[model samples]
Target: MADQQTLQKMRQLVDQLNEYNYHYYALDNPQVPDGEYDRLYDELTALEAATGTWLPDSPTRRVGTEPVSAFESHQHLAPLWSLDKVKTEEELINWETRLHRQLGDLANDSLEYMLEYKYDGLTINLTYENGLLVQAATRGNGETGEAILAQVKTIGAVPLSIPYQGTLEVQGEGVMRLSIFEAYNKTAQEPLKNPRNGAAGALRNLNPQVTASRRLDLFCYQVGYCSDREFESHEAMLAFLRENRFPVSPHLRKAAGIEAVAREIRQMEAGIPQLDVLVDGVVVKLNRYDLRQEAGFTMKFPRWAVAFKFEAMEVTTRLEDVVWQVGRTGKLTPAAELTPVEVGGVTVRRATLNNFDDIQRKGLQKDCLVWLRRSNDVIPEIMGVADEPDAACSPIEKPHHCPACGSEVVEKGAHLFCPNTLACKPQLVAGLAHYAGRDAMDIDGFSEKTAALLFDALDLRSIHQLYRLKLEALLPLEGFQQKKAENLMQAIEASKHRSLSRFLYALGIPNVGKRTAGDLADHYGSLERVMAATTEELVALPEIGAIVAESITTFFGEERVREAIDALLQSGVTPESAEESPPHEATAFTGKTVVVTGKLSTFTRQEIKETLAALGARVTDSVSVKTDILLYGEDAGSKLTKAQKLIESGKRSDLLLMDEAAFRRLLSE
Candidate 1:
């Protein structure tokens, strides 16, 4: 048993250390030297080790450890409301106008508003009970979220305890400050694309240790739930948070009217680029709690608040050159090489130009300054010609010959394609890589670089030639050790018996992706049936259109393609028949159209798709108005965005958004 003196010492140390941490992390003001702080921390650690006892708000609990197997669903104490968005000042004014109209007689009363930066990061809800941090969760579908307690604990800015000593839930944005983001990217093997992604990816990462490494910061904005006390206004709640040392944003400003709020938003927009964190917009909220209640809410957004969203960041850069690259399908696409410029903190050197026609339509010329725009962490795109081109600047011309193989380029509709598929080196390499991808043949350790090496070293011109490779031939290639060569050979051998759907997808039929290939495999059940199907027969299927059917028929009719398929079969590539469906009870998902987005810890994309299919769901590659369900996971991107928009717009009223845990529950049912 520990003595009273030792326990008192431990308590004192914890309090002192926590104070130091609050100053350093939350307030950016260090109260003591690093050595002194470490000394106290070590003393506290030793005490805890000796006693086998820990305080509820002990500083030692801050270090992230023990990753959760899966995030359990957490029901929020209060519904986390999403703010309505406005792009223009007029729209912002209209939002206020609507709020006033909703309040009825209260419209005569001057409405006070609070304006703050709309942080561009993942939303987090932190819960505390009896002055100790109890839970942390994502915003998710609002009513419920993925519990991320372990991950949120890693953030130093989040207080472990509050003075109120009551059950409470506070809302915040988990952000990786620009300074930390820059420092991390300097040494990261795969540098983070942007700060927002860095924070989102880290928070959603399954491993708590990975989340700790990113050094995330949180800024508490609203008192989401409070059991013991009620604040009269938003300002009073913010004051209570500040009193408890919560990392609240210092930029929160009070505005008298809609016009004042608009002025504040303009000022905030001007300083957005200079801020330490990414702010996509400024949020304007009604300050009075009663006023907010009177204003009420729409189905998707709170009527009391509106986010004034900024436009996508655009910058001008010289279009140094336009390069045409051959894809896996032998289509030549134009990509612009620009003089590197920073757009929204990410350096942009390359931007998509779509095609030769896009360059002409945009009036782009070599050595011309062009407008580049990037938003929502998407790939930067050349928007238009920013300025007049130099007098001597050359107009981008359509190439008559393929850049890779010097074969004649053919124009089909709006795109250029190389007819010489066999001789084109780029096409062969890309096709080989695609054939060996995880979704295709499930070949491990196969990369585009390896494909290029094989194409150059082994004089390999076709996919079938890979099967003809010998150990002797592979051993002589650059970077090929005996173990690597053996592994590659084994992997190649194992790929022979892959599912017929995989084999069909690996064949790289134009316009036929993995989903289409799976559909074909499921419908035909045999390779011969698929190969022999007429365009009319193919198009009869609900998913298959005339164009897709024509493409499939045209591909199978090619003598060269038929010969290649035969060669692969002769080389011991015997694709397994499609799996027969077993007798099972009908599921709720039966006949439903489902879409999945983002990285899942429980299953790969193909695995999830297959699971959905087995449960009688029709899984699609994209979100649409017809999409019945969207199962989203960590770092969910544009599809999730689009699905949310559709839901908010009431265009897809039946569309349901669920997390992995919800999907698992449905599976058990």
Candidate 2:
């Protein structure tokens, strides 16, 4: 046993390391060096091994003792549900036949299946008292779990309080997208292995502050208990959860039978990356409550629902070489050059190493035999190296200097950055390309390839120079037609009159996304006012936090940025604020929240949202009691039913259903 003094030192070391780990892993920034962090981590591991009194809170416990080579044991509350697995149409037909055999004549009754994206994340149970969130527990050894209420609350999509003042038990999965995970990993300084790992880490975090930074989102798919209401079908249950202001999966659809379910699943699989969150498979559930009860639980899993997991996309490929690419922010990222290997029906020759740390962690070497797999059917990544070593292979090393500027690289958390920000050619080119993007200036002929050509051939170093290019200079360049060049020039000229919001968005200020840009534009009314505003003043605005405010201030404070803005202004590219029209007289829908769902024949979703925004109505993505009206269009799925129920219950007074002609007439009024 260690002495008192030794134990005190060990405790102090653990605390310090934990704090730093939280900062590095959770916050994406670290104050300490990698060597120093590793030393402290090693010390803790050695001490814990020697002492044999490992603390429960230790980071070492993150890697659980039981090798989860196969599925881990979980005792689900309602027998952790697993769907009947089916690969082909024949298997599906067999499943239907089995159901008929079990139910006998009951199977002949009209049966329906509710299909939903089997979200790729950790399963969690949320308990609420009087509509206010109380506790969130993970699906641990099934019966009990690590209470992570604090961490769960940090998720913006998870409501702290709901419209219904009733006791409820909500079951859902916390899903993270490939893009979100990539963004989070970029900031975290430690490369997250995959979306599942990222979600698990975010959910299990002890500090709410840590979880809040991760931007983890949730989708409630099931209701275990409800004091005030009961649902007859799985679809109805999901609808009820949404009505209570719960974040439910957006991709849920009610299918008539197995064929429809299969179709929906196929559609979801094809469009996985387009979704806001990650889904590994499709969950098909028996819609009727009676059928669900009849086809009840096994000891470990439910008999009703089955998880039709998508086939794993993995292929062995030869690592030809590694190449480092500089991003717009001057951060160096490594990409693997691989011998072409097909995975997930797509030809794959390249994969992201994520960062220098990832490269080292995987023990990747040149000519190494590596297994590549698409994480969530998107973003091909190197999973692991082969067991047999390649005698000719040499270990890959990160460049000590930036390839673009030849400047010494500086280690900033997980990323190695070139501090020669102004001198980097790639940074300037990328920034210019971003400025000319479709959502920004909307330049017609400015493709990324064209942008590179202009930067290299024309000596155009800044976005400001694009407007000054003479027709003669452009006409001489290879493949430059007179009409195309003139069109490009005209487009640049037209972009000058863009709205303040677009201008703000085009600046590419860190943390100032499209929505934030809109909010800033709305609040400030002009770009000049926003530029003149101090960090304190910016932060004082509603929804604008210190981080965003600081980024804005820092962006404007830069000499290069100021020069670019001034040059653009001088070049006749001016951002003008749209004149505010007189407020409309209070209509029945004024000061209300409304949700529009399903196929709209009169107006597009965008048009409806715009009309609502103009009429002083808050347009939300989902339905709830706060939702004053749910304007239902044709085939308006579960939301329409949910809205009807709320209206019937007298929880909401206004529920309006309109066909195409009626909705068009209402808009006109």
Instruction: Find the candidate with the highest lDDT and give its number.
Output: 1
lDDT of 2 by residue, 1-669 (tens): 766776787788867877776555434334344435656767886887787756555655442122122222332333224344555666666776667566666765446888888887777788766555656777653454566766787688888767776877788888777677776654332456567667777777643555666678888888876777877988778777878888887787787777777788788789876776666678778888888787766433566777676765667889999999887777888989999988767788888877878788788889989878775555677866865656988889879999888999999788898888665888777777677776667777787677788888998888778889888888888888999888887887888888888888787787675567887888789877888889988876534668889999998998878888899999888887878878877865676767776666555556778987777777765566667777776667567888888889987756665455665677678
**What's the TM-score of every candidate structure?**
0.51, 0.60
lDDT of each: 0.80, 0.72
Q: lDDT value for candidate 2?
A: 0.72
Local error of candidate 1 at residue 337 (angstroms) = 1.8
Model 1 agreement with the true structure over 1-669: per-residue lDDT tens digits:
568888888889988887876554333334444335656877887888888887777766542122233566788899887666677889887877788789999865568988888887788999877665767888765777777876888799988667777889999999988888876643342346567667877887765656777899999899989998988899999999999889999788888987888888888777765678877788888888988888887655788888887875777889999898887778887878999998878888897656777788789999998877775455566667766777967889899999988999999888898988888998888888889988789788788899999888888888889888899999988899999999999999899899999999899887676668988998888899999999988986646777789999999999999999999999999888855768456887887888876657787655888999888888765576778999998767567898999999999877899999899987777
Off by over 4 Å in 1: 1-279, 282-289, 293-303, 308-312, 581-669
Q: For candidate 1, which ten residues in a row score worst on lDDT? A: 61-70
CA-RMSD of model 2:
13.5
Clashes of 2: 6
